[model samples]
Target: GVLAQAIPARSHPPSARSPRMFAWPEKRGIASTVIRSADTWQARSPLIPHEAFRWLHSELRLALENFDPSVPGQEWQGKAMSEWLREYYLESIHHHHDAEEDVYNPWLAALGAEVPPSIASDHRELVATIEVCLGLAKSLVGGDASAASSLKRELAGMMDVLEVHFDMEDEYYSRVLVDFNVTQAEEGAAVGRINQDMGLEGCRVLLPMVVYAMYAWGGPEVVEQFKGNVPPPVWATLESDWLDDFFCNNLRVIRRLQGRAEPELAEGA
Candidate 1:
């Protein structure tokens, strides 16, 4: 039941094959690369460009609110709530930061002969935080109530730190990286490497979930940018009829939680 248990619908697609891909195509002029063999299929790596980060920021903000216990179980369960936090904050978020450390930081370091101390310090801090969060996830999973409570507290602290961290990133991106004329091709190449490293199936599944979360947060402009950058083949399954319907419905639920369509902020929004 671990697999079937209360895992949140993956915010991005994971490596799994969805039935929707079988019938859906042409929805976005990105249907030519349909994955015919799920077994041999590999997934694309998740790379968050500057715009993608902003989109994620929006989505996470909404997700935290909606997943908070103040909202009812009819919306999203406690286990799923915890899983969502673990998946995004613990896994995805850390990986994204690691990407920066691996790729962008090195580039900066090479240019300057030394990486900025502030950035280095931030990376160390993030490493420490990720370690603590990994433990917290384990504790929560182990059913330690006191640990869970403490973990939640730490999680909240991490969230606060994350807001600032992401803010710093946004500032840096606008001030410095934006001037580099970083192209989608360059980023895509990096993403391709990451994806190949992650394997095709893994990439396929995770990218969609993260992409959806970004869209749920960043709105249409971000989505367009995402589509523009991602290879056409990577999205063949996601653009299918079933997934389209599914993702839309999922968005509505997210909106309800985040108070998107409402005249005012809805439930958690």
Candidate 2:
């Protein structure tokens, strides 16, 4: 599968008609009506990396420990998922930085908050490491057996930097919306801009990754609320199409590989 594509074990809410995600929503005017509870969803975008990075921190360390990539039939699925996950982790970091520098930071400044130079510094350091990890991932995904161990160790070392940057951004980057009382609609507009920036690739990739990865921290309802923020054509079937296809068909093996049990997905049950 392409690295450009990827959500939820909680259940797929039955849509009378499941929408296909062939295109993103056309850009349009956002209603100026103030949105209540916007800050939570506002924080959700940047915080995705916060949660995803933390989760990947452990999963990356566990990838090699749990399964042997060299085994052809026995461990192939695990090997593939591990490789896909590595790529997914890298994508999350890249998108997180894009959101921060392009959207989140300006809002922070608008609110009279200055993003510390160290945050960008940390990003440069993290992104540089991420580039190296992505290379390792490209090799591992390409079936280079040796790449797994190297990628694992690099990620382990990267965690110290990731955790520090996350905490720093919590104080400086993500929290600024609430700190300044940014309205939900206002924050939503910002998210829309991000959605616009993310455009097609984000629709196929980051959207599902965030929704599913979010389950680690926020669970199903959180996914629902987060869905409201996702602007649509994709949103119409975000769960039913992109998310389910990404998770159930593609990522289901990961649960088995990780030694966790998942219910068989019964459509319309």
Candidate 3:
């Protein structure tokens, strides 16, 4: 696999405390567990905000970890990783920003509060930064070792911008959504529209990524929210097909890089 080729096995044995740190199957089960634990979908608050942030943070962290310039052979390895991250950034973060600007912002403006221009400007800047990173990644892939350092710098800059941007967007939007008395159904519908716009192929990739991020960073509340929001068949396909194949492999590489233990999957799952 691509991940296995990139990240070598750890020299030290897995410790009892962190037995499954890099364990993909165990983490995959977390999503299943979250779904199974939910008895109902009674909670009606919008989950898009929390889930978006979770996915953004988790994806960025994973990219940064792998993009670390100090890591040997990052020049070549980072090319593929960066390409993957670029696609994710576009499909998730960029898509989210577009949705906010196109749908949420206009809707809120109609309701009385116009979203700040600074947020839109931030999106533009972030888009440029992502392009720079992608360009650097392309250069690295073309055998330019020096481009690795530049790619790392761009990724760092992107992270800084995103941290501020995410906070600002969340605070501003949360307040507006509250003030406008937007219903959970409305939010869900908006997100559903956005997903539909993304098309089937996009969902095939993004859905699994979303689930993976939810498990990684969403904690209990977010997990419950995800379980509530997502349908059973959708969740099943994401878990069994997409996640088990795609995300789990990459996550295993990340765990190995972090020197985490690989936990064993449960008996049945």
Local distance difference test scores for all models:
0.48, 0.59, 0.55
Per-residue lDDT of 197-222 in model 2, one digit per residue for the tens? 76555555566655556665566566
Point out where model 1 deviates above 4 Å: 1-78, 111-115, 178-184, 198-206, 213-222, 240-269
Better of 2 and 3 by lDDT: 2
The top-ranked prediction according to lDDT is 2
Cα distance off (Å), candidate 2, residue 120: 0.4
Work out candidate 3's RMSD over C-alphas: 9.8
Candidate 2, position 133, lDDT: 78
lDDT of 3 by residue, 190-252 (tens): 666666666545555566556545555445566667766665555554544555534344444
| Ordering by lDDT | 2, 3, 1
lDDT of 1 at 32: 11
What shift in Å separates residue 257 of candidate 3 from its native position after superposition? Answer: 5.6
lDDT accuracy of residue 74 in candidate 1: 34
Candidate 1: tens digits of C-alpha lDDT, residues 1-269: 22212233443444253334322111231111221111210111122333333344455567555444433443243444455455534665566667677776675455443445676577678778878867765655544545545655666676667656655554454334335555545545655555554444344335655564444434455557667755554555445432443344333344454655722222332
* Runs in model 2 lying further than 4 Å from the true structure: 1-49, 70-83, 141-145, 256-269
